[model samples]
Target: EAEVAQSPRYKITEKSQAVAFWCDPISGHATLYWYRQILGQGPELLVQFQDESVVDDSQLPKDRFSAERLKGVDSTLKIQPAELGDSAMYLCASSLVNRGDAFFGQGTRLTVV
Candidate 1:
């Protein structure tokens, strides 16, 4: 199926290093979102972008996590000085607007030690 793309389905990293992941949304979609899902928890919105502009990033940890959708097509997320508590499932989703169900990628699982 034509779908979203993500890299490094799993990652292992030291607690103080940096890591990055990438995502590509389906064609013709205009809204993109980044979410963090801890084990046994619902997905939490980290950031949202409308086209090339950031719409919401209230939950994102600016000191450790950052994300961007520059061209508004694909996006990248980075975590610097990773913490053990940062270990979780980083998911990427895309939708036509902010109100509907979004198509989700398999996610990148980060494990910090």
Candidate 2:
């Protein structure tokens, strides 16, 4: 089975620094999502995309965070001047139209000092 692609599984940075993460969803999947999980909290939707179009991004912290999906296949998330509160598990997930179960990558954990 093909695996989801992710990079820099762990990241450590000082507060007010910039950080970014990348992900590639499974081939043929139409929907992709980015979620933020804060320790004990469940993953919260940060953004959702259908193909190359963004479906929802109401929960995203537009002030410091931005995300995009290019060509509807690969995606990237960037945070400028990162804050200590931004430390968490940033998960990328995707699902096919017929499949409701989203497959998640191990996630990129960010730690800000």
Candidate 3:
């Protein structure tokens, strides 16, 4: 079984449209993070949640991207008016407390035309 689950393994959308990805992390993990990875580039942090509270979202595009873990069980990432630059693999990972082994989801690949 997968340690984490992500939906819609692949997605293709036109530019200026909207897209969203979902992720369910392993049970009992208290820290969750959202990352975006462009082709040939390393994953970049988008947002982080410690339980139900947001601890970091400095790199997130607040104007067009938003992430939330309301109850801390699962999380969602949404991008409105997605641009070409938003085409990337969105990854979700969870850890014990932000400093231990991280369990990564399969990821959602978004392609903006």
> How many residue pairs clash per model?
0, 0, 0
List ranges where model 3 is wrong by over 4 Å. Answer: none
Give lDDT for model 2: 0.92
Note the Cα lDDT for every prediction shown: 0.93, 0.92, 0.92
Which sections of candidate 2 miss by over 4 Å? Answer: none
* Candidate 3, pairs of clashing residues: none
Q: Please provide, for model 2 over 1-113, each residue's C-alpha lDDT reduced to its tens digit, 9 standing for 90 to 100.
A: 96677777999999999999999988988899999999999999999999988999999999999999978999999999899999999999999977799988889999999
10 residues in a row with least lDDT, candidate 1? 92-101
Q: What shift in Å separates residue 1 of candidate 3 from its native position after superposition? A: 5.0
lDDT of 3 by residue, 46-96 (tens): 999999999999999999999989998899999998998898999999988
In candidate 1, how many clashes are counted? Answer: 0
lDDT of 1: 0.93
- TM-score of every model? 0.96, 0.95, 0.95
Residue 63 lDDT (model 2):
97
Q: In model 2, where is the ten-residue run with the lowest total lDDT?
A: 1-10
Let me know the TM-score candidate 1 reaches against the reference structure: 0.96
